[model samples]
Target: MPNKRPITSEDLFKISNVGEAQISPCNGKFVFVKTTIDEDQEYRSHLHFQRFDETSSVQWTFGKVRDHSPCFSPDGKKLAFVSNRSGKSQIWVISTEGGEPQQVTQSKNGASNPVWAPCGTQLLFKTSLKLDQDESVFDQEEKKKEKKKSEPLVVNRLKYKSDGAGFHNETYQQLALINIETNEITELTSGRFSYEPSSWSPDGKSIALSANLTDDADYQIVSDLYLLNVETKELTLLTDHNGVYTNPTWSPDGKTIACFGNEREYLGATINQIYTIDIHTKKKKCITETWDVHITDAAISDMRSGHPNPGPIWSNDGKTLYFTGSENGNTSLYAIDENHEITPIFAEEGHVYGYTFDEDRKFAIIGLSDASNPGDLYKIVLGEKKKTRLTYINEAFLSEVHLSIPEPITAKASDGWEVHGWVMKPHGFEEGKKYPMILEIHGGPHAMYANSFFHELQLLAAQGYVVLYTNPRGSHGYGQKFVNACRGDYGGKDYEDLMAAVDFVLENFDYIDQDRLGVTGGSYGGFMTNWIVGHTNRFKAAVTQRSISNWTSFYGVSDIGYFFTKWEIGACFQEDPEKLWYHSPLRYVKNIETPLLILHGENDYRCPIEQAEQLYIALKHQKKDTMFVRFPESNHELSRSGPPHLRIERLNHIVNWFNEKL
Candidate 1:
């Protein structure tokens, strides 16, 4: 590690992301998606295949387009994947022996999420279609028509617009079946509801899926598991309509279905648990009822993309199930038996975001990352602690750079509750040398800051700044009570936890300069930054990105604000305006003394740019030190997946602000 240079913002282009790995049924070959930024600054992803006996992986498909979601046939003779090589995303089929891939579907709206049937003769895919539109219409060629004048967008539903996908249309995600041999297509189900297909029955007579069939789906946020008869088209509801359910996997014998979901006991704060239902008796039992961790990949990092949940994958014998669980600061793989006994398979101090098991369930391909590594695939045996590294995608980049490895730290709140987090020392650090420190907060208020590789944090550490990030009360990975503790108390105990984290770090680490402290976060973290500056002037600088300032107006403008406000803040503007106003950071703007920097995305519908605008203007009117920076055509995910140049610009702005003010 001697004579190595620190990582810079431009190093983002050198990291290659590997995810969505699938092991072939025969256990001889594995395919995964490797994403990299092209010279045009646009993302290019393709399918990569490697044999278990081979020493290196080979690119299966060559293109500048995106090709992902690769699935193998039951016999492992052919591969079906979704690709945009035909101008739009569609299913393509190719033999395992390597040859030209044939286009399977030519739908007008494009097709995705392809799954091979048990017989390997047909494929199940998803497409967008109007409620009354026939499936055949998608197969027809586009006809030229005269251009018309622009029309206004007529809105009726409360959920009209989304963040990444602008406005809502009349189209709904519908399921369909296509025969690969004849290229014949058949529509499965149709209506206003959207169905997400999970697995097919062993006998191939039915399919397990989840959908919200309620009449008022716009208001009622709930989904139920169902069994769709492949031939008869009869739908059978498996769960009550009071909870949210998804990722339904059918048992091998077809007598039971396993899924991950939770009742609305705590609304959006409820943690997901695994459940098994008897198909014949309609009796459901919570398998992971005693397991308190969230049953999904909730780790937040900027170095990963397209990581699937790796839901409950059942063993071939139907006696065991494998899935990923988030706990503490690690997302690990676990297994549950028929007796409801749980065991950790690969519980390491890293993020296992994506994984796949072979047909025999003896080995698995796991995608893992930690503080210093971007990510790579590992092959692990079922009952062993040993693992063999498969892919070294970031080996060359890591060899030339010195990345800070974060040390795990915890702090005790005033109330005696322990808070967990990690601290990254400045690059090229020496003993007895004081350095400026920056407190980095993660969004999701529901998402956890885990042992994952983060480009932003590394860049900050490389800039000679000690970075402190913690999982406060609202973050997942902890038990249910801890995650729900901040629901109704937005800036209450959560704020205390953050302040305590900073105090703990200063007390333990003597090299950190107390006078040169800085704080920055995005989304919910942004809100907390605004709250921190308004309530306390302990930090010399602060940066809030895509943040919320006024809750009353936020409830009307944000995409999920109509219900997210009431669910998180425990109040609505109409019913309890005073309570909502109390949590608004803008209310205490008069007390803010720290130099504040506001960063926002103009097209962000989650925490709209208006939130930043209000905060910047109020601080300006009061003659406070504040500056506003906006990125055009960027959504709420600008920090993670926005344009490459803009993401670098955002990083530069943060580094510059702290260097100048702190």
Candidate 2:
């Protein structure tokens, strides 16, 4: 093979990657979803399998349609997974030895997360059905009638539209079981509320699930755990409080259940911790309470697919537990014993996004991505913490292209808080020459900018821009105190932390051109970019994506706004209108002079397009150099999981804007 050319947005089309691994019951084989873009320019995912003793992997399914969520039966002979080949997503089955897959269900609303029964006689899956309907009567033809009708959307629910899922329908997700032999489907749970089936009990007589059954479910973000009897469909509450909870994994003995959740003491800013509940006494204990670590992995990077929580994987002993978490810009596997002593099992300079353990639970197949690798499977010794590379998904492409190595840097903020960041040098760089720099900020304000592979940053570096990203005070990977710092303070010290990073880079890195500096960010990072340009003209250009410009409107329009505003910004419209304006970037828009490029998603309900609209309108009225590019039909996740061509266009917009201005 010859050396490949520098990576372009189009190069993404040729790349094929794998994720969402599932171990077979025999512990010797595993299956994962290998995703790639076809000629239609749409993402096509197919299942691929590899045995522990095998040297290479074999494709299990062939299709341009998506085939994901692989689940191996108890005996390891049959594999059940969700696929959209027959139309809407539904459960499909195939023999592990190699055979044609059989479509099991034809639910009108579609099915997902198929989990096999303990005896392997049936499979339990989730599907969205009409509120009052009890049978699987909504078939394919009925769906056509519903889709053909030109009816106005009627809404009365407190929460209506979602970003990607779109406007609220009367239907809600419920758990259902399908007998494998008879192909008989039975609705296990039903109500106006939605239910997410997590894990089945050892005996398979009951299942653990989570749902928010509160009167004002939309206003309340917290969910309670429940145990649903497989036979009688009886619901038993496992937890009750004003806190968010999910990912329930049962113990081997079925006496205790391990789960992940947060008390919401500080609301959305609260760190997610691990908990355990006794099935008999119903007593729940916060296992990782005293620990300062955020049990949930919050690392941010572009080279990833879906961030599903691979919840607490219990060892065969059931006394030991393992899970993945983010800390100090790296996400790795961690272990927690019966005594609640947490230890980093596989901490390294990369991101461990997903993993699946063998039947013995001695080893795991890990999905790893870092600065050098896009993503690949690695076999890891759980107890020894040793890693062996299994697959080279992007090795060939990477060997040809020059990927910039981001040198990690650290500095003290204006408030004396330590700020962690990295500076990616230009590709094929000469130490003596100067280069333009771009300060990249990540969203989630609570999300950690980690040592992970990012397509956008690499593209910019390939274009000769020194890209710098940092984990400011509000970002995760740090302790609870640090992550909660920016809450209620919004643009205060958090802004200082980011600026300190830029200052450290300019002062320490001699090759970076000071006058040619630029800044760009998305979501919360976008809010900071808008605020940064408003406050200082230090940067020559700025790009804000899916950003928030007005706190007043963000409080009501966003999906999590009603309470998130009260938690993050400290007030609502009526409680503190003046304070909301005080922190909003729109209020300080008059002071901006930097050439700004506003990138936004029209369907973005998280920040809303109004944020970009108002900012661009204000700048245009003042005759400032500003342009707003709206990506139609895209939500907040336009850069990550949006249309492939549109994602390329977004990258082009960012590169061309900086190339032109900086």
lDDT of 2 by residue, 1-662 (tens): 22445567777776677789888888877888888888989989899898877757898888778998899999999999999998888899999988899998888788898989999989999988775445452354243443465778778786777778877677788888899999887888777888998999999999999899888787778888889998999988889856888999999999888899998987888888888999888898999888888886798777664656768989999988899888899998888998988888788899888987888888888888888787888898876858887777766677777778789999899778999999998876787999999999999989998888888998998888899999998889899999999998988999999889889988999999999999999999999999999999999999999999999989889876777788898988889989899999999999999999999999998889999999999999999999989999789998888888889899999999999999
Per-residue lDDT tens digits for candidate 1, residues 195-271, read 89889999998999999988899898899999999999899999989899989998888999999999978889899
Candidate 2, residue 145: the lDDT equals 40
Q: Determine which window of 10 residues in candidate 2 has minimal summed lDDT.
A: 137-146
RMSD (Å) of each candidate, 1 decimal? 1.5, 1.7
**Which candidate number maximizes lDDT?**
1
Q: Rate the local accuracy (lDDT) of all candidates.
A: 0.91, 0.87
Candidate 2: list runs displaced more than 4 Å.
Answer: 1-4, 132-149
Q: Candidate 2: lDDT of 580?
A: 90
TM-score of 2: 0.97
